[model samples]
Target chain A: MIKDSTIKRSKVTLSNKYKNIYEKRFSSPLKRRLAVLKASSSIVSLGKYVILFGLSFIILYPIIQQLAVALRAPEDINNPLVLWIPEKFSFKNFEISMIILDYWNAFKNTFKMSFIVMFLQLFSTSLAGYMLARLRFKGSGIIFALVMFTIIVPQTTIELPLKLSLTNFLNTGVNLLGKSTTLYLFAGLGMGLKSGIFIYLFRQFFRGVPEELEEAAYVDGASPIQVFYKIMLPNAKGVMITVAILAFVWQWNDSYFTSVFVTDANVTLQTLTTKMMGISGNIQSAISQAGVWQLFDQDVTKNPLFTSMILNTSGVIAMLPLLLMYVLLQKKLFTEGIERSGIVG
Target chain B: MISKLKNNISKNTKIKYANDDELLKIERNIKSKLAKYHEKCEKLSAKYIILAKRKQETNKGNVKRIINVSRQIQRINTKIQRLVANLNIVHEKKFIKRSIVYKIKKKFSEIPYNKQKIVWGIIFITPWALGFLLFFLPPILKSFWWSFNDVVPSGTKILVNFVGLKNYIELFTQYVIDNNNIFNVQILLFVQNLAIDLPIILIFSLFIAVLLNTKFKGHQIVKAIFFIPVIYNISIISSTMSKGFGLYLENNTTANILLTTQLTTFLMEIGIGGSFIDIVIGSVERIFMIVNYSGIQILLFIAALQSIPNQLYEAAKVEGATKYETFWKITIPMVTPILLTAAIYTIIDSFARAPIYRFLEYAVTESRYGLASSIAMSYFGINLIIILVVLGSLKGLVFYYDKR
Candidate 1:
């Protein structure tokens, strides 16, 4: 009886609170308008959540679908009932893909190349960016315009000729093609993949820094190079991270330049991206070469769907490292790097 | 006692005036040194000009002399500027003007602080400048030249024969690929598609960025998801997907028809016009490509949006300006510079992934280097023209918010 009375009392208070709010909302025109505004804002927020949820799904759909497809048993490739969830989860596809991709070897090569290129790109592009931003001289305007031109011109336009020059290497008769050194050369010279954009980013960022910081250093007997090392670089931690991440990511995913400069056919140097591209065109032969046909029946091996499943699995494994790295570094990348990149200014 | 104190103050004043005289003497010495360096620089520069004229006339034997003379002139100019900088600091009274290390540093600083910056700038850019001249400029010029010639790779060297405008005429007039696909038609279609896609991408990305910038639940996750496409190996995923499920779906003709044709018919039944429906359908079909292309653009726009100060919004609210008005007056104007960047990026990226790449690739595989270069050159020309047009038009609209 006491419990029932307390419940009744709480219900009465809730109803009384609602009644008071209703009465207050209707008490004045301003109160009514504010009540409507609050309701509309709630509605807007609801719509925003809906839109964002739907778009995020669209963005993530392929990755999610690929993961699901890759995890399913190979026998389920033809099972219409097994759409998303796997009936029997297995690692058979990943094993076959690793053989086809030469996963460990390619991963090692890609990591080394990307890491070294990242540092070289940082050094060259940041130095050039600082120069363009702080130091003015005759013809620097022309140089800046040329940088834009380099960004505009597609790499394909110069690929054939660049390859030719690399073959001869300035009449030294030393062929630099099909070697990792070519990529390092490009990076060290600020001509790596999308280096123009990185340079532009750094320039914009350095321009945003107050001039007085450098001036004070100068007045204290610091040279320009000393100022760059002591004052400017430490303060540009934000853009440095931004450019470093971009340079590393772009180099890691780069297939065109890698395929052109470092041909796997000649040098045995294969990055994951290049490896994936190589296998994608001839998956059936590659699958056969991996000797997977011995394990699976002719029926399963002959199916095109099985080949696609293998291809999809390979794609997943190839991008797995990048995805993992991104997950770990994304907080810093999003908050500090991109927000302070100063691309707009 | 008062008289004694006054005498002591006078003595101190006399010492202070004597110190002032010493400073003046130091300033005079520095000025004389600067004047002597200036005279030496003038003499060296006059000699440099004479040597340059002689080298141009003789075209031989004077290059080293010119370089040496120019180097001397640069060194003397730096010394003069350093002396002037020292003169400015000499009035500080605490500046050590006569230490042994100071004298050595004066000789080695080689330039004043300001002039040193210029030299360092050149030093900093040397790698890029050398790379441009050695790697970029030559290849570009050579390719442009080779486009007009018949280039053949013979052994380790390429042989060239002057073919005039034959490659160009052939590419434009009668180039056929894969038996029936015309090159001119493909290029035109690519350009047409680009024209349609660029604005859709820019507007969609900007809209998404604006929404993402607002506080909402799961905002971080959504933002992270949107950027996945930037890191995605898009070529591999798209190829694999099409090979796997997309092919399966395409083989089923009825399903394909049911989705797009049915929508079109329904829209037509409702009296929607034909061309508008085509655009709507086209965008719907290309929605995946659009999303992938706009990842970087969205990031750029988000950055641009975040950089705008909050005071503008607060002031607008206080003045009774609605959200729409604020978006137009404050948001749009503030992000216009990034808008230009996103537009250029969209155009260049689209052109990179354009189907014309296959044609160029085919030419390369066929060993027709001349034809490949022609295709590349023409494509680059169109790209430059489009970029120039966009830059010319958007130059006036990009509003840089200069904090200074």
Candidate 2:
């Protein structure tokens, strides 16, 4: 009985102590304000997480929906019972998409084109960026203004005339249209897809690097080229990686430039994006051409939904490689590249 | 001393000293060149001694290198001695006149170092400048010029007929596609939409970037997810998804729900006004597009935030400034430059994907290259005007932090 009483008394004392501390926290105006501020901050952080989660859900919703739609059997596309989860998961969609897209050939061409363009863009844009940032001279302001002009003007504005000119190509009687080399030429000259932005990014990044580093190299008898190679390039890894990934991805997903310059309707050379675009426009005819109609029943093949399902699958397949690359490189990209790219400064 | 020797030589040779100044210049140049050779010889000998010691210690393949280097040093020494003897003979008898090539070279070397840097700068920019001239400039001009002419594509060539302002007149007044869609209306709506969306996108992206910059739980994952839209092919994905799911959603029973419409009607019944509801519904409808479009902007903002030195925040903290105050005072001002960049990027990006592209495409498909060029040129003019306005307004607000 005595032990029980003592335990009860100790419990009451513990409650009393907590009450006293809680009362002390709000006993003064300053303390009360601080407590309220802390609570509000915590609430703000909670709200941030909620907003972030909601937005992330919105961002990822379509991709996940696409994946779900791609996974379902073609027969189940119109099945009212099926919603998110596929009742009969199959690779038939992927197989048919591969056939229609000429998956392997287009993948090879896209990868090669993107890779080469990425490097060429890096070389040309970085050199131009370095010159603009560190190698200022008379009329450089005009050059920079021109660079901004390039960025402002949409590619559509110049597409027709550019095509006409490139068709003749300096009056040399060389048809650069329907050729992959044209894409390479464009990239090597810093005229690739979004090359202006990459140049601007590099310029901002190089500007952020302390001039003392370059000055020291100059004092050591290093030429400007030597300084760029040994000093500036090493310090520019962040921007370079950022530009490389962006350039590669932009080129990979590019349809406008590729459609205009490289992939003529009569040409066999097609990147994945162009192939997807080409097939998507006439999926019904393309399916019959690929002989995918033999595997599916007439009812299924005739369904417009079935065509869309195939198109959706093709879209997923086209972006799957980029998704994989992003998943692999996102960690470094976010942690190293974006944080240090100085794209804004 | 060389000048005196040149004078004596000129007197002895009875040569008119019209170019005697050139002779003195040559002597001075030779002396400087000899000094450079002497310095090189010293450096090579130092290297030779180090290699010889290394050879003795390791007894390795450096002997061949040492012999070759010594021969090089000997050759340089002989060249130097012969130059010195030649200088003595010139001092006694003849004063050689400087050649035209040498004078030209000297003139080139006399260029200021800063001017030399300008030349190197031009060299550095040569590739891109050439690209701009060849690929960018001519096409831009030709397209602008083409807008004023009827361009017919002949075999690998374009046949141009100057059409004056006919294309522009048709485009502005009578150009109608699908029997109802006017180019003027479409472009106006586009600019109106841009005016609405630009600030919304900029503010939303800035908010998200600030939040992402904070150390929160799952920060890395959220950051990664935020950038996924950068790689997303918005046009293809949206078109495909709309084709499939838009149809499905229409057919589904859930399509009748219409929560937003219901809310709008209820608000109207209660008299909350129409324009406010329109804005709310409009932004709500475009939320997805806004998020997608702001991925790169968010990236830029996050970078700008990260680049803000920690000292400002710390100093603010020491001064007992609140978070809101610090954000406004330290963060916003610091990020203003990036804010301008993001704004310009946002404008250009949206313009590229604008619905006026359909009008341009319509023209292309119809083989009206002149009309297409006019459409493109007009769209560009509008874009440039908007950008200039943005720039002019933001010019005073963009605070460039001069780190130097």
Candidate 3:
């Protein structure tokens, strides 16, 4: 039910450089007054930019702090003089975290599940959307309303029943949560994380396309399915990219859904994070069992810094792929996709 | 016979076109006078051209002064003109825009033999609809049903004894386990916190959107910078808030950490009520988180703002409306639809990730499924009521420009 809401949510990249009333209005005036207004407004804008800069710093601060801590050696962390920049940089924490997190396995699992969900949701939501947008039938309104209701009803409300139902399905001596079956099933049904939003997006986008295009296809003897596949899908590339990236990002970052759906270890980054949280509960025991813990000269158990460093490193590792993705594809995802989305309120 | 016919046709033509001889003489006299007048006009134009050139030479020195005087008068007139204020807000009744889906549906319904089209519609929707019916709906209803049952887990089988409203009743009216008020307190506090967070998040996002929407240098970079928090996602916040630096220590002990800003300390020193201070500080501390959450809302607002035709603002300006008046009258009305959309999104987002949800997660972890379902159901019900009320009220305020 995340479909419509997801479209609404998908539309979240703030646009800059709007022509505000004051800026436009103040431009034309008596020469002296105009200059005064210009000077004052520039200064005011300078202040705003400074504030914006400070806010951005605040937003970036946690990641920066994590990076700093992740880089710091135990000794460097202990030093009172060191703050943001670590004096003795180290990759030891990362090394330990990689082994601790089972990075390769977790990465593979995360990618596998995310890609599956992404593709499933991509087809399901769009098809459903196109149907709703173009197809007229009895009870279609009710179906659309129900779809909206699903979006309204938070998943947590049904989390218990969903789990119970799954458990019931698996009661014939199979644990389904440990496999990718559960994720596929849920995601394929347009009930995946924000899948409803994707569907809604497709519907909204399809509706925005002039009826003449589809009608022409219909007059030319193309079936409804052909019209959708041949005409509609090609035109919906913007939304497709938008939804795909959003679904991927959400699935990748998703701890709750992954934690609930995939109970297995290393099934996704989220499940890995969930597992990490569990490990933190009995961290000392887990560490002592590991041979790497013994390699350290000092008793790592005595230091709070060591524990935090490990957590920070894991957090950094979990976030790195997303950060890299953002850096690489932000222009396409944020600018192009968003601009072409045409998502009305 | 041909000549006689021609003669009769000519006579008939002459009779039809009969005109007086005096009329022809007057027409000729007028033509001759027009030629004489043309010659006189040419001579007069030459004399006038010379006179005008002489007049321009004489008056060229005074022209600049007259122009300056007129400009001064115009400026005075502009200055004297009263700027009209939109003192009264116009509550115009607006109709919602008819979506193309509805239009197509109407058209399809009007056509005869639309069974094939209906089948195609059903075929397309069948997959998701089936998924919804089989998977989505049952779980929802099952959860609701479970809320009314006392579920027990046996070795291989589950025992679900029907306990009608006992869990919900015991949750609110009485404390079942050791007379503890934890459930009531937690639920109340969660609701209260939501009440606070909703308006704060909404107003903050709207304000920020307006600020960010303004043109400035490096705006693209600023937008990118602001959107960083959204990229970081919800887990980062939960991790940082719950278990980051000095987390093992008590709450007050973590105050000295770099992540903890001086605003909390300042508020504490000011001696505000303890709970109130905590709420305020919590909100302040998570301002970045709020900004993160508002990324989409800001975009929605910006998009809405962008869609507003420039002519409305220009028209407002021509009527001498102030920026404040223009914003209230034009911008706000134009953006209310998006405002509602964003608000609903914020409500859903916040409720979905609320502390109560965290509590429900804990209950699930502890294998208290029945109790968890009740909590989830109750939270869902309350939020649904709230969303309905909010949307209903806001619906009236939304001015659909398309209708206009």
Candidate 4:
């Protein structure tokens, strides 16, 4: 009976100790600490939104600035009060941008080259990828390694040699460097505009397919060629769309390759933008040559601002189509294609 | 023991029906007959499968999905065929062991499968190989050769003089007319830029990706805003930023208004001094410069983060780990391999896509091809060294899970 009483007493003491600890936890000091933790975490989350929005503003700054400037009259551009909203709204900048960019003609030329190369790269890269993924032949491993090397190596390493040698590659006494067909020729060979990445994507996607169908076709008296055509190619719609859009977008933005191959007379939209980047320096000379020197701004110091204005408009014009394309196809490319294509590594 | 006993009983039944030699003959006949029958069935089923697949393809080009389903169906079909064949197994016919084709195959064993495979492989990659020869090879060789020699342009043809690394010699030894150390300064500045930008971009993207990966509203719109810069051309971005920044700074009153009341200056007034202020302002400026640059890295990090199993986090939480500890210990180790990929991609993208490369190309257009090639080769070499160094260091830390 004494032992049982002691046990009950100890149990009661233990309960009292637990109550004391619980009360201490709910006391002002500890409660303040808990509240601080809660507040800090909420602040962290709020900070994330604040930071994200600020960065977003920085990214949108140029586009927004350009929009404001493009809509402003020339006189209002110099007005100190005119910043975000123009005093007088006008479409003069758009008209000037169109003429400077030679918008329609340059668009036609760029569209032609970009379209042809995009298709060429689509076919050549797909073929290259198919051979590497499906065909098991000796030295296939080595060939694939070379294809990977092509992707890794910078284009600058080869651009000079390519330019130098292509002029005389034909040995037909005609320099092939400046011809429009050269872009197609290069692209058709699987050496153009991120084709290596496309080839890699195709190879990865093809590798994901089970070997059973191809084997069955082979056993059913289908040649390797027939198997690829009838079985493999039809099953590659996702990658086809993915690669096609990628090729088109990349080729459209390509100023480096086109600059090397095409000359001044064949200026595409990208080349035209680059050409106009420094047109402020030549603006005076151009004005003088046109015999209308007095109509333009003769002050050289203010030419840079004029140049910036032109560039802002041209940049907007050049960027608009791609932005539209992205808006249209971003659902497919950004979320679906990126995930399935194994582009993240 | 039970299995052995069962096996012996089956053998005894077969032997009871016939003498031991005839039983052995029957067993051999059954084995060969079953093999031949299965082979024929396999070929027939393969034909059926091909027909079914072709029909399915015509019905709908389902791509990757249909193949998996059809493969499953084929598996079931084969199993049923095997079970039916076992019920009515037949005797074997005489096998052709010494056909003329076999004899010829033996004679040509030296050429063998390897040779035929080589031929087919060559056929498969013929277009790329041919193109590489026609277009890629000559230029690559010429670039290397041109770096050592002098290229002089004539009316119709060019003169190539073998100067034995004279171009490289002049590049390194000859001082520019200006007192400034031009090449090294540019190289150092580029390296500094990379060193500054690469880590900041990587860490910033990783941070943003973590935030975005959380269950938040409007993440998609924010992500689209961040990625819009990627869709915009790099040249355009650089040009716009440079020219726009120039214009912004040209307005003295506005510049003073923006800079004096900036976040960095406010932080400075609050006792954040020394290099912290510089770093803060520098990062802000770089964030503006390379805001779009982090899009792909963010996407990649998000992918890697999502790929990490949730159970790991649950386990870590149960173990009383803090969020910071969980990130460092669990998230980082899991995403290290992906980090390496992003690093390599960033290195390549930064190296090749720099706006400064336009100046290098400008040199080539102005008939300074030899000097331009030398400069390019030098920078390319430096880029290679940098890549190798990054790979060597990071590869050690990367936790590559053996996917097999």
TM-score of chain B of each: 0.71, 0.70, 0.60, 0.62
Model 1 Cα lDDT, one tens digit per residue, B253-334: 3554577888898889999977899998898778778888899899889888987888989999999998889999999999
Residue lDDT tens for model 4, B1-404 = 99999999887544323445654565576567666656765776675577667767776454555466556556656765664454243223222224566687566544634454445556767778877788776776777777887887787677788888777777766624235645655677788778778888888888887887776667777777777776677677666656653466346337534764587769977999997787667776566666778776776687567667789999999998988899999989888877887787688778875544654655566676777777777777877788888889888888854441
Off by over 4 Å in 1: A1-22, A265-267, B1-110, B155-157, B246-266
Q: For model 4, what is the alpha-carbon lDDT of residue B167?
A: 77
User: What does candidate 1's lDDT look like per residue over A251-317, in tens digits?
Assistant: 8888888888887522488888888888888888998898887998777777778888889999999
Question: DockQ of each model against the real complex?
Answer: 0.51, 0.60, 0.27, 0.30
Candidate 3 residue-wise lDDT, A1-345, digit = tens: 779898866665544223343455554677547777678878878788777888778777677767877887766655667766788888887888888777777777778878889999897888889888888677788888888888788888887777766765735755566566788888888788877767776776787677899888878867666787899888877778878887887888787777777776434443555656666666566556565767775754466667666776777887788788887887776566655666555
Task: Mark the 10 consecutive residues where model 2 chain B has the least summed lDDT.
Answer: B13-22
Q: What is the C-alpha lDDT of each candidate?
A: 0.85, 0.87, 0.72, 0.70
- Residue B118 of model 1 has an lDDT of 83
TM-score of 4: 0.71
* lDDT by residue for model 4 (A46-139), tens: 9989988888887787677777767776656566676677899987666666766667776777677778988999889888888888776756
**lDDT tens per residue, model 3, B1-404:** 99999999877544322144544544455456555645554665565555556658875345555555455545433432311111111111121234567788677655643465677788778779878986789888888988898877778666788989998996676533334536678767767777777778878877777777776787777777666666676565456436745243325345435445566677777876678777777887768677778876776676567657789999999998977799889988988877887888888887777667666766666677787788888888888887898899899889887551
Docking class of 2: medium
Name the best candidate (by lDDT).
2
Best by DockQ: 2
Estimate the lDDT of model 1: 0.85
Q: Candidates 1 and 2: which is better by DockQ?
A: 2
Poorest stretch of ten by lDDT in candidate 2 chain A: A261-270
